[model samples]
Target: MSTARDVPETTGITEPPRATGLTEPPRSAGVTEPPDTPGDPAPAGGVATAGDRARPGDAVRWRRLSRRMLVIHPIQEVVRSAPALIGLLFAGSSQGGHGHIWSLVGLAVMLVVGTLRWFTTTYRVTPQYVQVRKGLIRRRVLTVPRDRIRTVDVTSHVMHRLLGLARVEVGTGRSDKKDGGALKLDALYAPEVDRLREELLHRRPAAATAPSPRRDAAAEPTTPRPTDQPDPLPVPGNEPGTEIELAALRPAWIRYGPFTMSGLVTAGVLAGFVSRIASEGNVDLLRIAPVRQVVDRVGHEALWLQVAGAVAALAVFVAVASTFGYVLAFWRFRLTRTSGGTLHVTRGLITTRATTLEERRLRGIEVSEPLLLRASGGARLIAVATGLRVGHGAQRGGSMLLPPAPREEAVTVATRVLGTSGPVTAELVPHGRAALRRRFTRALAVCGAVTAVLLGLWRWAGLPAWTWQAALLVTVAALPVAADRYRSLGHTIVAGHLVTRWGTLVRRRVALDREGIIGWNIRRSFFQRRAGLATLTATTAAGRQGYSVWDVDLGEALHIADRAIPGLLAPFLLRAGQPSDGMDPDPGTDPIVTSPGA
Candidate 1:
């Protein structure tokens, strides 16, 4: 069976997995139930833990965060408030120039609040669960069961690097919609981060929850065991698996970075920053000498020439910004498999990051290609694993298997990771004519709205005739977008995976494992119902917790779900000539299977 990092170490150390790091000396020392002394900070209750050192009274130990946070937090707040501070400084004599006074008070308040978190936050690792306690006034305590852990992410920003500090986030296999996806420990002594990560994942499942009074005579002698306990327990993460290098960033791949669209975001941020500064300073951008010169030169040029110049400038800006962001985030990116049965990703320039994902937690992966990236013949890979952050944030997308790169390279990496060529490259079954017509209808409605708005402005608002003409011409592009979106809709079931591909601006093909699907949702909008189509959404406890195949024939949607999980939907479906019992075919069997490790 494929298992998560079965090795007891987070770094993939090949130690013979152990049930208890609890040495024989401790047990033999006549310390039954881990003696509680003066410093014992708990009631005599907690779930039994499998793999950990038997340090006297702490079935778990409370650990404090590093003191270095007191410095780091205040510095971060100061930097964050710099823009606001500058604006206040320029609030000027017209308002009696007293804004600086308010800014000072604000900065002091921020510093205190930021620094207070360090003193308030406390966390600990125990046999049963990982718990974090924080919030000075509210007294919030977040607890997550250890067995559900799926990913460990460690990151160090520029300031953190200088101080030998790192932040760690432990993901508890919670869906993004759920509260408390991770328990974060900010500003830990860098080396402690490693030790903590290893300890947390080192857990092995206990042999048995209830040891029977009647022992198996034959099995007792035959299964000679260590730990000498009645149960020769099977731990969750202690299954055997080998590690291998999967993929790594190549220098040539950097050429595609500009097409990743990260640049466009950076451009927007830069523009916002510039606008904020100008507005705060009460300065007119057009009054600047360079700005005036550029405007005059462009105004005097032919209309086509002016348009071409503006496009060229914007392209240059985006390219530079994109390249810079790419290098900053992925300079030395490397993806490798560690013996612990985890996929380890390490990358970054100024702020380094290391993310470890248990292989068993991976439900599937997403191969995405935005419009520009597709045009540039590139694609990216995102791992769809439980507890693997799913958004664009740096802290979240630790699941990024590959940045934008050649489509062929992406396909190869995906094939290797998923371990099947069939699902990775199989041709998808397309949504038929009704779905196609629906796409066109939506597209035409959008174009019609835009054309109407432009015509109103040209006639009633006295705008130039060219305005409506340009809008009408631009609306025609929506037709191609509609076609592309329809063409993108397709899905197929192959090799234990349900592959669904869709989207126009960003085409995404997701290959999700059938075993991970917990349930199936059938959705039909009013328009969809009229068209005799439905959307099949596979609900899993992993990735986004849901992946949907849109605009599919109703019967086919049922077929896809049934094929994905043989008996899952059988209870709900109206089988041939059979009356509905409103329950599963097998009444005694549990609908939810707990053994797959999902």
Candidate 2:
């Protein structure tokens, strides 16, 4: 067997070896293998060893990012701050003295920062970890274990596309509170990013065998046979099996965008912009001839009619804006399954983004149906996977699988993506009367408090008496909401999946894999205890980390936990009439409580 001292510190090779159909002579017992020369071709049919790829040395060499980054980084910075730059220019113009100089100073500062960031940063990939070093005054080095890496996302904006560059981000499930885990390389050659992604995410097949030389017949009699050896662990970047197209954008799906809340969001943004511009005393849109004409035309109309017309106009504006925004974001959306069970999603019209997620990291799937979309039998699917919560923003790192597709289509896509044949929609077990009572009680308390406040305002603050009627209407509205909330609470287990359903206006049904659950947490508040209800939380490394089956019976919760993972909760459970005191149960034959449903 070769020893540690036999390995070379550095290979001194310029490029990776490729298959060229030639074989090198075996090295002598203690001799280190020489690195392949710059122009040398690799032996065909001969696989390169780990040492041939990453050269182990006393100190790993630091590799700088592609020099193209110097130009790309500054352009990215300027583009990101273009709106701020425009505002600064406007402010400077108004101030008159040296405003242009200040703008130039700001640009200079950004250029300097971008330049320094490029020069100081260096990264190196080794067998065990991917390391990055940066900072001019206070040096910082970030090392991420290869095994911990969960996702490799490639994103490119217009500027990046123009320069033939892409940004690569490697994520581990853990979020970095300060700099979002810091494994991002801002600019690299697009092809290199693709190679890096494959290197980081691919899982080699277990059946692959390394090349071996035959031993002498005399010594072979005492040696173990190759067939008796266990399979080797999978290696990254060794195999990408096949690619399968899963979903793609359809023209018909565009109609669903107007029904989504995205329209309301766009309307709110427009309203805010108009309000800001008006507040600045720069331009009053209402003073325009067309606007004045419309206002005058509606001036003589009934108050209710005028209000109705304005609402109609706003709705039209919102719908149009939302449709445009949606098309821009998902114009050419495509979901594809690549080799080694990885999912690839590519979308966006102007600035395209490609996200890769390994199948092993996925815990479950969530189907969300808002009130409007549910009426049309439409739903959105989100992947409950690890490494999705890397950033602190609401974006949540590319969890969306289907955006407002037909419910049936969404289910079909989900089943295919999860590699399961069972019915995606399982028979749900309702959280009985106790949950309903809790919902009603909470709703009643909220309505009563609001009514009391309105009564106070009406009496002492001299508000109109109609406010009391409005308060009554609000109180009555809570009943339907409470009823819907109660109707939405349900959970079930089917075909190794835990199906959980909840919510009213935005109903969500999640199908979580039983094997993915790592732990169980049973929680009961004072109110829940009084009602004999307990919340059973299934903790997993993926998909929001923990999903709760709320307001379940105490006995049912324990039974569910025990049934989900047979031996996990067995030791903690005790048989009836055994003991009131807690004691460790026998490991070999523990009795588990089971109901008919279980």
Candidate 3:
């Protein structure tokens, strides 16, 4: 019954008392277990179920995180509580040094709280679930089923690397929700982290079904990874099969960074900070000596020249900021695959991230081409997978497949990742003339309204005639944009994926696995109803939760839905000469069903 091998610490394990329901296990000095209530409901943090307690037959050996955390935690606490500490310092300064004593007291409190985490937080990988018990005042147990595990992200920041530790985040189907992150181990020994990640992702279910929790303090899970299985990550030597080199960072790609417009995010943050400081100090930015000098010089320039100069200055600033940000974020970015049926992403110059995505969980990918990036022949790639969110501007979170690079490199990487160029490069079927009309009418209508408002202002509000003149220029500008939007509109079924493309400024082309779709939604607007066009939404339990195919011919939309997930809308569709479920059609009200399952 002794399962501990090369794990001297777990060798001294004693099984938990069944009568108490996971109350506490034997621990070393300075380690304390949180009190467990037998009949309480599970806390907000997810544990499989309170009822799934350890059985008498199972051995639950609780273990602590890396002792180095005793140092890391306090530093993290100080950083998180910086504002509060600063406020206290100010108050103490105003209170004639009484704040010094309070500051000392605050430091003591942080030390106690930070130290307690090393004692109170204990995790265990049981046969059925991976669990972490934390919190001193409000003891909570969080867990996720090993069977449903979707991803295992092992990250090591600069501090973590220096400390020889790494954080392990376990992602499951349910763990992808907003309330996820319940199953994370802040920092563990680097060796143990790798072992746990390997075991969790590469072991067979039958191999680890029996819970034998006797393991050393720094030991990995006892479950051995199947030799036949591929390594989740392509380590230097233990690669199971020939590693397929997908894409790697090219030094020249840095030139494309500025075109990504990622600098706008930095500009926004700086602008907000400047505005806050200006407001607080009651200072006028325009009144500043340097600003005034520039203003005076510009005031003498022609309007067009002034505008051009301003634009040029802004562009230069953005380019510099964006290029710097890009270098820091994707310094050594790489994407690769293996015969192991996994896609790996590793990047970051300072805070390194190594992510492994099971090819099985990968539904598809999205190719994003922002206006500036597109104009510069650059693009980025994001994963569209279960339990992974689509990252917003500048920050890809953990879903980035490729950083902003040449569009050709992006497409090449995407094609190899998905195992086919048909989904990545295939020409999509165009939506009919109705969609073209819909796209243009909406754009023109908005432009017309703005122009009319400006014309009225010029006529009655004593505004200069230039107001209407500018509106006319805008109306002229709208035509090309409207055409670009129409050109971006396309959809088709490629291989087993439902390919969709739409958008203008930040264009996204997504190729989603049809098998992942759970339901179909058909939405037709008042104008769309008249124009005989409908937007079909493909609902899935994955990225974005829902992907919409906007502005498609109503009949073709239905056909696409049927083709995507055959018979999903069969029950809700109208039969020739027959009403649908006693609901009349064409009653001047558009028919829309949100996720009508067949």
Best by TM-score: 3
- Which ranges in model 1 have alpha carbons more than 4 Å from their true place? 1-60, 83-117, 135-139, 176-180, 204-243, 392-395, 449-468, 571-598
Local distance difference test, each candidate: 0.71, 0.69, 0.71
Residue range 1-598, candidate 2, lDDT tens digits: 1100111213323222333323533231111212222222341222233433333311233456667778877766777777677678778988786667777877887788788888888665543456666678766666666667777778887878887778888777763244446388876767666656765676321222331121111111111123223224323432453456678888898887776767777788878988887887668777889988998999989999999999999888877886887687777887777646688777877777788888888888888888878888888888888777722422336777877778888888988887774536667889899888998988988887888888899999998988877887988998999998888888888788887888889888888899888899888898888887889899887767888888887777877788888877767777463332222455566476444573
Q: For every model shown, what is its TM-score relative to the native structure?
A: 0.77, 0.77, 0.79
lDDT of 1 by residue, 1-598 (tens): 1112222223322221323343333332211222232233333323233323333113333445777788898888888988877667666435887887878887898799889988787766544456666777766656665667788889999989998889998876655445456778886887667656655553323322322212211111111122113222223433322235577788898888778767878788989989987996778999999999989988999999999998888898898888888888887887766545677788888999988788888899889988988998998888988776676553346988888889998999899788787776999999999899999988888777888988998889998988788878877988999999999999999999999999989899999999888888878888888898889899887777799999998878888888989976776666663322222244345476444455
The 10-residue segment of model 1 with minimum total lDDT is 216-225
Candidate 2 C-alpha RMSD relative to the actual structure: 10.0
Candidates, ranked, TM-score: 3, 2, 1
Error (Å) of candidate 3 at residue 180 is 3.5
Give model 1's TM-score versus the native structure: 0.77
Candidate 3 per-residue lDDT, tens place, 508-563, comes to 89999988888888787789888877898998877777888889877778778878
| Shift of residue 327 alpha carbon in model 3, Å | 1.8
